[model samples]
Target: MAKSVENQVEQTKVLPQYVAALVANLLVASVGCAMSWTSPTLLKMDSGETDIPASSDEKSWIGSLTPLGAVFSPFLAGYTADRWGRKTTLIATACPVIVGWVLIACAEPARSIPLIYVGRIIHGLCLGVAFTVIPMYCGEIAEDKVRGALGSFLQIFVSLGSLSQYAVGPYVSYLVLTIFSATVPFLFAVTMWFIPESPYQHVMAGEEQKALEALQWLRGTSVEAVKEELAIIKENVREKMENKSTPRDLISTKASVTALYLSMGLLGLQIFTGIDAILFYCQDIFAASGGDLDSSVSTIIVGMVMLLASACTPFIVESLGRRILLLISAAGMAVSLALIGTFFHLLNNNSDTSSIGWLPVVSLVIYMIVFSIGFGPVPWAVMGELFAPNVKSMASSIATSFCWFLAFLVTNFFPTISKELGSDYAFWIFGIFAVVAFVSVFFLLPETKGKSLQEIQAILGG
Candidate 1:
């Protein structure tokens, strides 16, 4: 027992630096998600539209750009991270985020529709890079026992960042919000200079001693534990070296192809379920659902609920496990969507009286809670775990980029989809997707509970 306690202490020594880097990464990631939240609201206000897009054609075109950027940027970011190192890739991507925000803040003054699209596309590109790279960094740095917890927290901070935007959006001008959003990336870029690069990247670069020191700094472990961790890392690196090939060779391999497909499927599920569309247009959904409010105060309740659910994720994730939580959350979302859809269906049928006055509001809130709990966090966490180190960056980029593509699809289509199908059918479509996601999680995803990064890699046949 005494020896075990000593071992624990030794294990903890390398954690401080890692925690610092994690926090920095979280800040940047949160900002990236927040920018997405803020952009739609700012765009609507700047455009002076009574409803988002104002027309179906306009909506589809605008929404399509998001996925277009998402689909492309990940490949670029992922390859870049693998080639240049995660730190450099992240720092380089921050520049676009800054530029995107500046364009957004200047939208009214600029009065250009093309500029808004450009800004959003740039923001989407930055998001694609940040999402893929940050998770890879966190997963690489974390101790085995804490990896899930740390990786899961990335989504939590993303929620926090998103919630911050929703909180501030109503109270502040679009210009101020855009400027504030841009500041986070700039700060993240500056601070990252002080953080150490990933130990895995150091190892890949053949800096064995530097890699050991990095692991030591990241783990906060004693020298002996550091050595043990170093041995594991070294073995993993050697395996990767043995299997090393050009990107084309890597892509041609069966395991790599399987991992890529799984990544893309996971991301596609995340977007197809309509969460981003819901999140981006929550206020509009609420208003359409019979809640009466102007654009400014429209989604406050939904945003608050989303924020609360996001806050609860870290607490529940470990206790419930990713699979169970996701299943439960997905089930809840399906039920909520069904309820909301029913309400809309009733309203569409009746139109004469307020028969289901409270149903829409109640159902929308329930939908938001369900989403925040399950689909929002779990997909990102799973994506982070699904790939091995050799193909991690490429796989994650493909997944995240696809996620954005789907996000673009859903967001762009929702307004028009909602208009044509009516609120009832549009939500039902999401409900069906949620059910599909639940099944996928149950059958397709492996139990990654308490696994080390290398263990996870081994499971995936790295």
Candidate 2:
């Protein structure tokens, strides 16, 4: 049995393969569709096209409840990912969103608002799982040469999915949109079975034979190379797992504690930068900015910019490196948001002469462009790169839970801030956060570009 395993590991490898990354992103794309589905669906319901017209409070609840559900998903998904393997957990998570789409499809015809809320919550759970698992899977499967590109797919497909909703949702029947959305997760589940499981997961489970097979499929390398990589992975996994990793052990090790703090801090900064808030209220921002474009058209424009920028990231992440891209993105976002806030301040103060009426649109486009290139995609990419194998699930769960919790807070509270202190204050506050994010990247964030997962852990002092 040992000789047979050695012979299998000694087989020549294939290089530059992407089956794992491609399939994982397909699933991530489904979560993206779920995230943005509420935007146009709510718009349609508020327009009274549905059997039951939704009240404003109901609309808010529907929009906010997604993050609420996300708060619990990490626990379920983290355990499942660690226990069942990343591929199975991802396939399982897809079931909830598929069911969510069905409920959404039925709600309008049946005149049941409660059903739609339930659907949103279910979709939220899908988001939580996708955020946790896809990055981990991609990080594990990708070779260093292609790792940056693979990692970037998590955000790229998300942009594409959101763009799809902006483009298609407004034009289709609510039922038709729901049906279309349902197809993504269904397809994701079917396609994922073909991809290799994460080598890290196999190593952690002490299935060295399975790990070698998975690495052969993923790395496409010589048996020697496969064995070499497997040795490193095994050593890392054995060292970490030997301690019987627990929640307390997560903070006990310096590496574990650092990984936890870095992941949580990046996620926090990602939200506080206010891109999610901007996305959530794109139409209202445009309406209040006195732009000549229709709100829907302007919103689509925003989504397109985000999509294009995200598409560029996979091509550039390796060349620019994570820290540089993050720095550039953060500085640009800070300036763009500050300019946008200034535009709103001028408009609010009755000082915006007609000449610069284009400022808001210009600033917002710039903001989204910069955000997509760096902050939008990079944080999750980094999260996947950090953490030891034994503590990954627990650490990821804690970090992901923090992300969803803060997302809920920001999405829930931004409206109140806008109402009480004015939108200018909210934008300015986000701008400040952007500046702080830049400083954090410069002073604290470690560069993970072109490094192996084990290498990243080593750099973290694991």
lDDT, candidate 1, 1-462, per-residue tens: 567556855557445654655655655554545444533463455356422222446445544565567667767776788789988888888888788777756665766556667877887677767766777787788766667666666666666666667667656666766676777788787887777778888888888888877766676655556676677788887897786555684466655665566667766776777777766766566556664444335465566676677767767777777778778877887888888877788777866436656666667678777777777776666665666556555555556666776677677778777888888899889889879988987887666767876676566565
Name model 1 segments beyond 4 Å from true. 1-8, 11-18, 27-35, 38-64, 221-228, 245-264, 292-298, 321-323, 349-358, 380-393, 438-462
- The list of candidate 2 runs beyond 4 A from truth reads 1-16, 199-237, 253-259, 321-323, 348-354, 381-390, 442-462
Q: Supply candidate 2's per-residue lDDT for 163.
A: 80
Give lDDT tens digits, candidate 2, residues 117-220.
89988988888888877877887777666776777778888887888787787788898888998998899889888877898899888788889888877766
TM-score of each: 0.83, 0.85
TM-score of 2: 0.85
